[model samples]
Target: MADEVKLHGLAGSPFVCRVKIALKVKDIKYDFVVEDLINKSADLVKYNPVYKKVPVLVHNGNPISESLVIVEYIDDVWKGVSILPHDAYEKARVRFWAKVVDDKCLPALFKAIGSHAQEQAVAEAHEQLQFLENELKVKGSKFFGGDSINLVDISATFIAYWVGAAEEALRITLVTKDKFPKLKEWSDNYINCQAVKDVLPPREVLVGFFKSRFGKA
Candidate 1:
C-alpha cells in the first residue's frame, strides 16, 4: 500500500478543521475527500465502521476516526514543529483540556444552540461559556495550551469556528468583552490567522443557514 494520507470529512465542520489545522501546522500534505455527513458515503462507512463520522484520516490504507486521534497520529508520524508538549504531564494536561472541549464543551454548545427555545438555548450557552471562561483563566494561558497553539488549541478551534452561527441561531451572544474577554480576544486572533481566515466558511452564510435549520425558525 502507498504511504499516503487522505482525509474524508465535511468542509464546514469544526472537527474537520481540527485535522486540517494539525496537518497545516506540521506541513503534512494529504488528499481531501469531502463527504456529506447527513448522507454518508460508503467509503466513509468502510473507513469508520462505528461512528461513520467525518474527519476520518486514512493513512497508508489504515483508518483512524476522531479528530483528536487523527491529530496525534499526524503529530507522531510526521513530526516537524511539534504541537504536543515534550513532558508527559504537560501532554496529559493538554489532552485533558482537549477532552473537555470534545466531551462537555462542544456537545453543550451544539445542543444549546440547536435548541428550539431561544431563552433556554441562550441560558445554556451562557452557562457553558462561563465554565469555558473559567477554564481559560485557571489555565492562565493564551490558549488552553498557552503561547503557541497546541493540541488543546487544535481541539478547541474546531467548535470555536461555529460560535457566530450558534449565536445567530440561538439569538444570543456568547463572546463579549464583559463576559469572555480572553476567549473573545483569543478567538479574534485565532480566526484572523491566515490559515483559519482564508479557509473558514463565510460567517454570514453559516449564521443564515444554522439560524434557519438548527434554530428550527
Candidate 2:
C-alpha cells in the first residue's frame, strides 16, 4: 500500500463514525488519527483547512473532508463492498436519502437533543422521524439498501446510536418503540450489523459526552 490511507477523527463524533463504518464495510485498512475536536490538532487543521473538522481522510497525504464525501470517496477508490447501487436511478435514490440524512435528520436530531428551544426542536425532530418511518415503509427495505447497509444507512448513524445517548443524557425520549416502530427496528438492525457494531463508540462514553456537552450530569 504505497499510498497509505489515514483517518483523522474524533471518537465521539457521529460524522466521524460514518467514515469509520464506511471503511469497515469496504474493508479498507487505514491508520486512525484521533483529533481533539475541542482543541483541534495541527494536522487536522492543515488537512481540512476549509472546515477544520474531524473525519478527514488522508490518502497518500491528500485530504478529503465532509463525512458523506469521504464515504463516497472510499467507495469509489476501494472494491471490497459496494455502498451505492450500480444503476443511475438507484444511485441517485441513495444519494437523495443520504442528503436528507444530512440536511434534515442530523440537524433536527442535534437540535432536539441540545438546543435552547427544546420544545420546538423536539417537534421538528418528531416530524422528521415520522417522515423517515414512512420512507422505510415505502421502500420496504430491511436496511436502507434492502438487503444490507449502504450509504444512506451509514449517513443515518447518529439516529442509530448517538441520538439514544443524547436522549438519555437529556432525560427525553424521541425514537420510542411505540411511536416509531419501523424506524426503531431499522436503527436496531443498523447498529447490530457487523461493520457498524465493531466501530460504534461505547454507549456509556457517549452518554457522558452528551451530558457534559448539553445536559445536567
Candidate 3:
C-alpha cells in the first residue's frame, strides 16, 4: 500500500486546522488540498459522502472524515507522536475530554460566532468559558490535558483561538482572569506551544473572516 497521505481543508477553519496540527505534531507528511467549503470539490463529496466536509484525511486513498476522528486515526497510524496517553484508562480520560470539546464546547462557540445578535452571543460565549473554568478546578494543572497538550487541546481549537477571535470580532470580552483564572492560564499556555503557535491562523485574518460571517448571519 502507498504510504502517502493527503488532507483536504481550508485555511481558517478550526476543524480543518485540527487535522493539520495533528499531522504536524505526529511528524506525518501529507499533501494539503484547500477546499472551498461553500463550493466543495467532487473528491471531498466522494470521500466524505455523508457530510461532504473538508478536513477529510486520505491515507493512500483511504478517506476519513470529522476532525477528531481524523486526529485519532493519525495518532494510531503514525504511532510516534503519542497524542493520546499509552495507558488505556488515561487514554479513555483524554478521549473523554476530547468529546467534551466536541459535544459541549464547539457548538456553543459556533452559535456565538454565527449569531445574529453579537450582544447575546458574547454572553453565551462566556457561558462556555464558565464551564471550562468549573471543569478545570484541579488547580495548577496546565492545558486541557492537565500539564501537556493532548487530543482535547487540539479538539478544542475552536474554543481556544476562535473564542478569542470571536470576542475581538464581536468587540466583547469572554475570557477573563478574574472569573476563569485557571482556564485563562490554560488558554495562555495552550497558545504558546510550538505545535499550536505555528499552526494558528493569523488573528487579523480570522477577525476579517468572522466579521463578514457574523455580519452575513
lDDT digits (tens) for residues 1-217 of candidate 2:
4669999988888999999999999887889998887798889888888989888999997999999999999999988789998999999999999998888887898888778337888889888778778889998988988989989899999998988887887788878899888889999999999999999999999999888888764
TM-score of each: 0.88, 0.95, 0.90
**Number of the candidate with higher lDDT, 1 or 2:** 2
Residue 213 of model 2, lDDT score: 81
User: Of 1 and 3, which scores higher on lDDT?
Assistant: 3
Q: What tens digits encode model 1's per-residue C-alpha lDDT throughout 37-152?
A: 77889999998999889889998889999989998988898867788999999898888878877777777767766664356765666676676688778877766667677887
Task: List, residue by residue over 1-217, the lDDT tens digit for candidate 3.
Answer: 6588888988899999888889888777778898997788999999999999888999988999999899888888887767888899988988887787777667766776666436677577667667667767854478767667788789878777777887788775656789778777777788888888888889999988878877444
C-alpha lDDT of all candidate models, in order: 0.77, 0.88, 0.80
The positional error of residue 132 in candidate 3, measured at the CA in angstroms, is 2.3
Best by TM-score: 2
Q: Which stretches of candidate 1 lie over 4 Å from their true place?
A: 1-3, 215-217
**Candidate structures ordered by lDDT, highest first:** 2, 3, 1
RMSDs, each prediction? 2.3, 1.5, 2.2
lDDT against true structure, model 1? 0.77
Ranking, TM-score, top scorer first = 2, 3, 1
Q: Which ten residues in a row have the lowest lDDT in candidate 3?
A: 109-118
Which residue pairs does candidate 1 place in steric collision? none
Clashing pairs in 3: none
